[model samples]
Target: MELSKSGLWGDQGDGTYINPILPGDYSDPDVIGVGSDYYCISSTFHLSPGMIVMHSKDLVNWSSIGHVVDDITQISPKLNYDKMNHHGRGIWAGAIRFHNGKFWVYFCTPDEGFFMSTATNPEGPWEPLQHIWDVAGWDDCCPFWDDDGQGYLATTHFADNYQMHLIKMSNDGKQLLMESDVIFHQYKGSEASKLYKINELYYFFHSEIRVESGNEVRVVMMLRASSLYGPYEEKEILHTHGEELDREPNQGGLVQAPTGEWLFITHHGSCGYLEGRTLSLLPVTWMDGWPIIGEDIDGDGIGEMVWGGKKPIAGYPIVLPNQSDDFKHPKLKHHWEWSHQPRSDKWSLTERPGFLRLHACIPLEIGNFFTVCNVLTQRAMKTAKSEVIVKIDLTGMEDGQEAGICHMGTQYCTLGVCQQGSIKRLKYNDTGTCSDGPIIEGSFLWLKSSWNLDGIHTYAYSLNGEDFQDFGGQYQLNWGFYRGDRVGLYCYNEKTEKGYLDVEWFQYHYLSN
Candidate 1:
């Protein structure tokens, strides 16, 4: 589907919006309302400065605030990306809550147990990750504080032994009291648990991938009770019935407007999306004590997809997440993420003042293209067709140090310039197939990559930043773990760490067919 044509940006600008508020891969979103302010955090698997947190005044327009995991050393040594050990593992789905005049985000790594981080401000200086529980058996945990000041955490056990449990915790949000009561033990692939109190009843929201009519799809599962533990009844309130929405829209958080309007900030999982899972906002109606997302078009209790609708909270100008950067700031832009934790001394924005400099570093062991560390990247939108252009200053590059751009994922494609001593050679590495270009004598070049919505990525280069020529085969985009295509800027040397590359600027333009 043409993402831009389908209104992927969400803001229609007419006091109404489209389905996907976020076109790129901001998956497993959990949001909380702090007065007129709404903050949301997303899953950033294996990316340093993990648990991407953002804030919005009107919920529709959002911007990055900070990250939950700033000191990634607390996770694992393999997160350095040099090892490429944890592809899809680090900081899974989490819950964000505003309590006691503080913002707390609770998340767990599947192998690293439960962790929590808090900040007085959403866009923070979030305190260092508090390793709440160091045992890794369950995930998708949510922290709940009752009226009596008693604290509880709702968690889902691993899929191998699927079960939901409500564990007691200390009011200080520090200690888990061990005491766990099983809530539900029957739903297959039940996860993303959110515990909420509404109308004097405890509501547990989760998603269970179920097989209906021989088709596997995600169904919005909910269970509620009068007490925190036990005797909870289950119901499936939402499902995808239209052919337009091929995947299931589930695994997100519920938001209630100040005016009492309810909306589900959800992510629809497209198993085939190399562009990553997209986020959709759906109006929720409370019927018969059950919250139904989407529109009940067929009069069935189960909700169907709502393509476009009026704004949930209007009266604010359009604001969006960071997309492009010119490398003029003293630090990396909030949109830029390293392939893993980078060697801070190797890359610098202050070194060149206006350009982003990536000092060449030899890999621990050169395996796949992904093994190279400090590759900064941002999400590639599903805009049907898009163009990414970057200016590279190759003057300082030395032997074996290559610097360029690529659409990175499981099976990758790279378009770069490799400098062997003083001779610079242009090349395209489509996964493993190599295509060579003319040996250029210039110390500067312009590189661009354009692709359609179907993921047919094509690379191009220009000597003067004006005349661009396509090079290499059409590299089809692919996924690794839960990640989609990440347009990346990389500089690495397999032989020695003696070279560097300066990215003068980067411009991303989404185009139509």
Candidate 2:
């Protein structure tokens, strides 16, 4: 059902609002307006069914429509677990637009350069990925089709090699005109380029690096010219650091409201250690020839958050779905997705009402939580204190069946119940290894986890629901080198055999104001 809160936090009445419209860890947001509808998608690395597409009428409330990639098998014949080629390399910075009679999406896999897909509708029977531009280190590609039907691809190079470049595309939109490659702009750490035509002049906006602070300073730097390909003049930075409106310097998308108001949408870093990213929107105004961003009538460059303005489109009030699971439904929520191809039979709720049955399967060796098939996780929307309450029945669980709650990614910490002999004991810190915590067997078990904005700090378990003993000291939820961490449930079979854990339900409550 719909969560009580509409946006990130419970809706604040004032125009000033929280930065991220969708609180969860949806990074590198690329938004486009089709007719009167606003559609956006974010990067989903390694997580199968990549590229989540969301719809919103007010630009604040959003709901998932569908995904760009429904099956991973279509991309590759055989997927690997040890070191999957697509792991940590699925959909990155996708740009969606309505062109001609079809809806086109341009995305990058980093290792494979850039690819294009199309559908007659936003939520679609999307075509298989087609290699449009196959060049090393080129990513975050956005294509702009001028009124004259001429197409231009603007993109940035990888950090290890090459630099930002723009090139013209063939009319067929399949290949780039090789000789048309032009270095429109070059900054060592510049990427996520968006090309917009305002007042007859083409403007290019991108984010550059902040070497000193180690944060990617998202500067709305612009370059204007009369021609698409030209001696473009670099203008002053329209948005930069020091101003509270400008968060971490990174890539974002631009859109104009139906009321003729200009707005720039991008993400800001939330937690440096967790690499959590939050979305932010700022207003854009054109002065003289160049555009100024995050400014209002006061001439101050800072953008103030507002609510219920002229409708972006006509629709119902937008509300996000709740993450808490009552186990009343037969299947998991749409918000929960697996890291790889999911085995439907391995998970079920048909046998028992108000309970989720997770059949334990062979555990993999890799520590990357994104590759772990048994893990069920959801994105951490905003920096808040969230707790998960789980009621587990350890009866008949084999010695190898380990069931628990985890804050997982490349790194993780788990607290749950494990069965050994005639007793069931509380378990903790059992990450990447089999043995880590002491056992206290009981018929019924309850597990609880408390996480601050910085990650999970404390975990507790109880034989009876009333008394929870501290199972582990403090554990950090660092997932290797990945940008974000997800929290959810895990049940693994160490026996390389089959067993299952019966979970009563899971309740997640946000305690932060």
Candidate 3:
């Protein structure tokens, strides 16, 4: 089945594929190929199950495998959501490589430091994370293990004079030798450094912003040198070629397909949509020695985006990231990553067996609905005309409680059931403004949140699951932090620890980006 038919992106089953092979807010993607299989990781930021790992057979069709970090609390209390706010920061861009029979992933948190994790399998029981470097403010870290077993790690801290460094490291990537060299320091907003040794040369990839047509175009720059240090040649491989339709595609890793074809995977911040940046796969062609990405139609020695093309490696069909839960599984699906590390005791499926039962123990006090800790979220696509619905049982209402659907972004909007004393009212909260509907009789209601590609959102409620009544004004959803918008199902109380809701099902549908 095509990803659209399955409610997401990937495996169109046909010969051709769409732009974002893996859709939603999967920003700053880095991919690697091992043997006949391929794996990719993306920056999850504050979302738990940080640095999501996905697998593929053909390099185009991919699915969520697991997370690099199992215990996010090990990073910081800010990631816990209930403790402090690390909303805009967690894990940034990371590199994935197979070194010495172990799969290694290296990444950094702006506030914390650099960390590495290894796994025997991409779908992992990954080894516990190692904090390799204890320094802060340095982002974009990629690890390289050389042929003679000389290990090196490259990093870029753009905040400090656009400094890029190459550090010597222990073979196992456990210790970071601080004796480093300032490698490349040119270009404004230079970051997302990735290292590759190919054909007896080291090529460092980074994205830089250059003004063209009065716009900050993010161009991909490749630095190459035969020797590890000194006399490096630089060129821009990928960039935005007057993108009025799409933004500039930059900040991704390069990999060769099993069939010996080299390709560049990248992402660009959207101009119109605010659900974060979406992923794009560009075809790479090697001329002379350098690998040029995308199709060189104008023959300017530069490559632009390839909107649609044949799959790089074609074969078996694949599934997409899971959506639309019926609350019947043994546990919550991997598709669901908590806003932070969840409280665990507050939500359950076995308590009622077939419906998701969420206890409103956390106090919201009319604060931002997007800030609540256990708000279960999945990425909203970077297109118009996508909507989600939930069957919620608003029976166990306590005074000053609310629970329902939300469009969580820079400016969030909510349409849910709120309780005041014995009165059960249907409410919509847009930012801080609260509007209410009459008592939702019969204990259960179906709520829906819909939006177009430009992110104009609308909400409705139905006594029966078949029909719905419009209930809220339009909310223009915008991007938040470093990510796009995400639809969330949340429950919380203000007066005290009381109230709960039974979510029978959650369903979503997408058109395109």
Return the top candidate by TM-score: 1
**TM-scores for the candidates:** 0.96, 0.82, 0.94
Report the error of model 1 at residue 400, Å.
1.2
Q: Candidates' lDDT values, in order?
A: 0.81, 0.65, 0.79
Summarize candidate 1's per-residue lDDT along 1-513 as a digit string, tens digits: 225345356676889777677777887899999889888899998887788888887777778777888757678776875566777888899999988999888988888888888899887888877888888767899999999988888888875566877788877787778855555545788888998999999899988778877877768888878876657888888885323454568889999999899999987766434568777788999989999888887887878777668898879978755677898877666777777788887888888889999998887667477778888888887765688999999988999888899888777889999877778899889777887889988888999999876778888899999999998888887767798788989999988888899999999887421
How much is the lDDT of residue 478 in candidate 3? Answer: 73
Would you give me the overall lDDT of model 2?
0.65
Error (Å) of candidate 2 at residue 504 is: 4.7
For model 3, how does the per-residue alpha-carbon lDDT over 1-513 read when each residue is reduced to its tens digit? 222223334445787776767657778889898888888899888887788898888877777778898768777777885763778788888989998899999998888889999999887899998988777788888988788998888888766856788888886788888776556556788888998999998888888788866877778888889977858998877767444544677889899987788987787655335556777787999876777888877888877777667888877776655677899988776667778777788889999998998888664334856557578888877443677889988878789888898877777888998888888889988998889887876787999888765678899989988888999898987788787887878888877778888999998876642
Query: In model 2, what lDDT does residue 87 have?
Result: 51
Model 2, span 155-274: residue lDDT tens: 887654436678888886778887988787787667777887877888887766544356445455677898887678875444355324334534677787788776666665433334
For candidate 2, the per-residue lDDT at 309 reads 38
TM-score ranking from best to worst? 1, 3, 2
Q: For candidate 1, what is the lDDT?
A: 0.81
Candidate of highest lDDT: 1
